[model samples]
Target: MDLAQFKEDVIQYSKQIGIDKIGFASPDVFTEMKERLRTQQELGYQSGFEKGSIEERTEPKLHVPESKSIISIALAYPSKLKDAPRSTREERRGLFCRASWGEDYHDVLNERLYRLASYLKERYPDLQFRSMVDTGELPDRAVAERAGIGFTGKNTNLITSEFGSYVYLGEMITNIPFAPDEPVEDSCGDCNICVDACPTGALIQGGQLNAQKCIAFLTQTKDFLPDEYRGVIGNRLYGCDTCQTVCPKNKKKDFHNHPEMEPDPEKVKPKLKPLLSISNREFKETYGKMSGSWRGKKPIQRNAILALAHFKDVTAVDELVRLMKEDPRPVIRGTAAWALGKIGDWQGKEAIESAQMKETDEQVLDEMRKGLEFFTENV
Candidate 1:
């Protein structure tokens, strides 16, 4: 088999199958990333969503014993939503980040990887290959960087020349010894836009991130959002894009390449009030297809309450009151209490005081006291 010609064929086939960018990388142990992971662990900065131990994550040979090379692919997603719905004063809306705008990217990228694997199998017959998306043990960004797909940016995202940081990445580890491509020649060049723009200051000096403090990570958590970040979270329902949106590299880089990635304005930016009461069946039928809903409706509902507080949406006061008094989940009830306090309306305060009488949970009682204190402080 002509390995050189086969490499070219694979590149062309990847393009034909909707892969925006593809690159080859040698599968040696990721020495530098291993140290960085250790540092992040030591600092207690990890999101706890990480799938594997540091050794398993950095060592490709352990994952696929015969792994000789990794193939990294990037698919650009649209940055700007077309004909987006307006968030009216009467009915404010919450937004899902651009990354979760369409069908779950994990599904989309996995499908493409499977196709690539099948094509390679037809040619090499017995080639050993393993494909992975974001959830996999292997770090997709590190793989993309080594594969020369893009450069790691200050926002901790891979920024490709053609697509900027608005791209979904996936990889396949194979025994085939494809020649590695050169890393992209790009850097932030003293530009601290993403770092400076981070609301919670999650971006440490240089390129490291404190995931525990990141709003993107915070929005996905099932617990109550910290008081410091509640105001900063604004109307974001899932994920945060402030870091990427402020980067100059992503300017005018919107690409509507895949039909599957198109955002449904109503679904991605739905009315905040409706989200608070959305039934499990309704939430699943509407948002389950999107990646943002993976944490289920709890986080989104909690964020929606905060968003209403952010807007000071007097219209949502009744719904917030109901959730505070009747919701089964303590996190939801506690968050609703906090939002009512933040909104600072007479009825919201009254509701909190009434719930305080019946609330038995210590956390819920604490939240109710905090809610009442808002009015006390005002006087």
Candidate 2:
């Protein structure tokens, strides 16, 4: 097989099948990334969501033993929401970040990767390859960078020339020795915009991230949110976009190349009040298809309760009170109490005091006291 001609053919086929950008990379062990990840682990900055040990993550050959090359693909997602509903005084809305706006990118990108594999298999019937999305052990940004798809920005995203940072990334590791493409030139010199713009200071000075402090990571946790990040998260229901939205490379770079990649404005930016009481069946029916729903409705509901407090919507006082008093989950009950504390409405305050009488959980009781204390002091 003339590998060069076949690679061009593969690139053309990727364009035909909706892959926005594709690049080839040599399957060499990622030496630099291994060191950075070691430093990240030493600093206790890991998100705990990482699948494998440092070696499994950086060694492409471990994922596919015969891997001689890798194929990295990028599919651009829309940044600006078209005809998005306004967050008003009466009925405020919470937002899912741009990455979660469309269908679960995992499904979309994995499907595209499967198709690319199928095209390759048509000729090289015995080719050994493995495809991976975010859940895979491989570090996607590192793969994309080596494949010449994009450069890793200080915000830790693959910022492609054509699509900016608003792109979904996935990769395929195979034994085929496809010639590698040169990585995109680094254009982010002296740009501290994304790092400075991070609300929770999650972005460290040297482009490293402390996942514990990242709002995007914080929003996905099922437990009660840490006190400091509650205000910083604002009305985000799923993920935070502060870093990416502020990046100069991403300005006016929204791409609508794929139909499935478009967001349902109402769903992604839904009203916060109803979300607090949404039944499990209803929650699944509405948001189940989106990638943001993978963590289930608990985190979203907790964030929605907090979003109500962010807006200080007195109209949601009753619902917040209901959650504080009657919710079974301590995280939800406690988070509602915290929101009530933030809102400081009479009904919300009274509800917290009443709930404390029957609340047996020590943690919930502590949250209840915090709520009642909101009125005693200036805060």
TM per prediction:
0.99, 0.98
* Candidate 2 lDDT tens digits, 1-379: 8999999999999999999999999889899999999999999999999999999999988888888899999999999999999988998999999988878899999999999999999978989999999999999999999999999989988899998999999999999889999987888899999999999999997469999899989999998898888888889999989889999999889889988889999999999999999999999999988999999999999999889888888999888888888889999999888888888888787788888889999888888888788877744
Where is model 2 poorest over a 10-residue stretch in terms of lDDT?
Answer: 370-379
Q: Could you give candidate 1's per-residue lDDT for residues 1-379 as a string of tens digits?
A: 8999999999999999999999999999999999999999999999999999999899988888999899999999999999999999998999999999899999999999999999999999878989999999899999999999999999999999999999999999999989999988658898988898899999997589999999999999999888889889999999999999999999999999999999999999899999999999999999999999999999999999999999988899999999998899999999899889888899999899888889999988888888888888888
Model 1: runs farther than 4 Å from truth?
Answer: none
Off by over 4 Å in 2: none
RMSD, candidate 2, Å: 1.0
**Per-model C-alpha lDDT, please?**
0.94, 0.91
